[model samples]
Target: MTIKSLSLKRKKTAPHGLSEPTDLSAYRRIVVLTEGHTNPQKAKTAIGLLRFRGGDVVALLDSQTTHQSAAVALAHDVDVPIVTSLADVSQPDALFVGISPAGGRLPPAMQGAIYQAAQQGLDVVSGLHDFLVDDPALVDIASRTGARLIDVRRNGFRETAKHASFREGCLRVLTVGHDCSVGKMFAALEVERELLRRGADAKFLATGQTGIMIAGNGVPIDCVVSDFINGAVENWTLANQQHDYLLIEGQGSVTHPAYSAVTVGLLHGCAPDGLIFCYEAGRTTTKGLDHVPLKPLTDLRNLYEALAQARNECEVIGVAINGRRLGPDEAAQEQQRVSAELGLPACDVYRDGPGVLANAVVALREQVVD
Candidate 1:
């Protein structure tokens, strides 16, 4: 069956002045839309869903690279076939917008594809700052077809943090970064998995679009206003306090000129018990900010520690390296160099399993007698 002939059970995933669970698990066969963008950074949503969501993601929609395997470009282990249109794929439960453009604007091609998918009775899921529900044309078609518009970032802006602390005895860790897309979320996800495997009550707190989509629920902190960013983080942390470990995903670099506010806000709001410093192996400049330079792990560790001290006492306990650009031997060497210089265990979470970082967490927990 190429086209879905049934009506979608339209429901609001975005919490509008009300509390609701965000779950994307009901979508069994999702078609990831990343037309011209299939790279690691540009198509992060698609890549993340493929790598983490596993077999639920059926195909990648990229007309520019039709019939080509998306494994290499997306660094995915699965061979997600690239197709041109909705008809090219089988019965899709939903069409996922899998690229985060600078302005959150959908490309013309993706916009048309999403519309067609909705008209065909497939629910549309988006992670962009631009909510698809606002478009009358798309909404009208979806309404007529009984299809839902799932905007992941549309939730969690109505909160205002009255305090900036992760309640008492909350064993939470935050991933600090040298730059954006350097594997903070990936490392956090892996670490969460490892922690759970060890029988700990671990929860991965999603703070971005990709994380939100993968985890099915999280506050899109980047879309939050300056005054309420801290509150939003506080809100989510409070909700998940019962978990033994809350692995909060970090945002952009503190040195990043464009996204430093969210970084500092999370640092203050979460007041993490421990911090994991994530950095790319061979990058000297900030992504998309050519004029800005990325600081070394030592420098970032010191800065993050200092910033966290204002609200809570915490230390950077481990190093997670994003060595995607380097080969295995080179990545190993970089990890060794980082461990030696920083006096912390380091690993490329994607290249290696989460054992190293998880061990570091256990060490910290034991050392503190928690």
Candidate 2:
């Protein structure tokens, strides 16, 4: 897709929010707007987009790392130009708001960059809970300039969905974690990508903004009303139930002080066949909640399985370790120790690739069928 395709603007609404999500595959190239923010927690969405977009990411808008390679900055193996802004990238189709900072609010620097991109008629997409589509100024800019404001979190909510009777032999695997942002979405997406590479019919069911943007459409479960979280999960699952493997992106943590509700809701609602326990190797505390020590992986695994047993007989199949903060040797050692301790396959999905975990999950389904 070219920038012209994104300029077919529609006036947005307050309730359901903005224009429908566009299929990302159509975008020939995209510029991820990071505004040079490099904190891993802050730049995670940008990093994820660049990793999984399959070479569609043309440039990264980061003034701090401008003229450097994105691989060097994000610690990923992929290579993409790190440009200052949309102007630096020639004919990029869209601009993605790629920072998932502590608060969902857009930093002023990012806002200015987005405004410029919208004025330049680039369709702007964001997964941030701070809804850009609802901002009157941005709405007006999009309306006047005919550039669509695509809110990945708010748009494309599946309607008229029922509790699914998923396809026979198909599986739903939810990524549960020890804490918020412990690589649940990253692990889930990486496994899905691996399965797809193997020619398996796998789909990633996005429950968060970043996951939704990556998948092109999903329900941001955090944004849903409490009473409707199950319905929302059911809705998204039904939409993708045909795939042989549905990797649902998990949110928060079952033990998280603030976000436990969303975590339990996903566990109960998704009716997963197995869970992938995502963890950061050395993170002892919740990202923001320094007081609540992270539960041991065994405790976490048991709780998740017990919770799943309350509804269906789901189990924790493997562990997805986030070793981004560790050196290569340390990351490998940590994975080995964790795997031996848990008696489950454990690997850093990004650092080591998703093969080990993917095989375990696929084997689970096949073993059950057998």
Best by TM-score: 1
In candidate 2, what are the lDDT values of residues 53-154, reduced to their tens digit? 747788888776534777777777777878875778888788998887765777877888888888887788887778877678887787777676777666
Clashing residue pair totals per candidate (backbone < 3 A)? 1, 1
After superposition, candidate 2 runs with Cα above 4 Å error: 5-18, 64-67, 155-164
In the range 1-370, model 1's lDDT, one tens digit per residue, is: 3224422253533323322455776577889999889876688889888877867788888878644677877767877788887798877888889997666787777788888888987878898877887787887887687777888877546677776444454588899899988888998999999999999888999998888878878888888878988888988899898787889999998888888998998878777889999988899998887888787777888888988887876899999988878998999899888899999988988888889999988777666535
lDDT of 2: 0.80
Enumerate residue pairs that collide in model 2.
Answer: 1-26
Evaluate residue 367 in candidate 2 and report its C-alpha lDDT on the 0 to 100 scale.
69
Candidate 1: where are CA atoms >4 Å away?
1-21, 164-169
**True-vs-predicted CA distance for residue 33, candidate 1, Å:** 0.3
Best by lDDT: 1
Question: What TM-score does prediction 1 earn?
Answer: 0.92
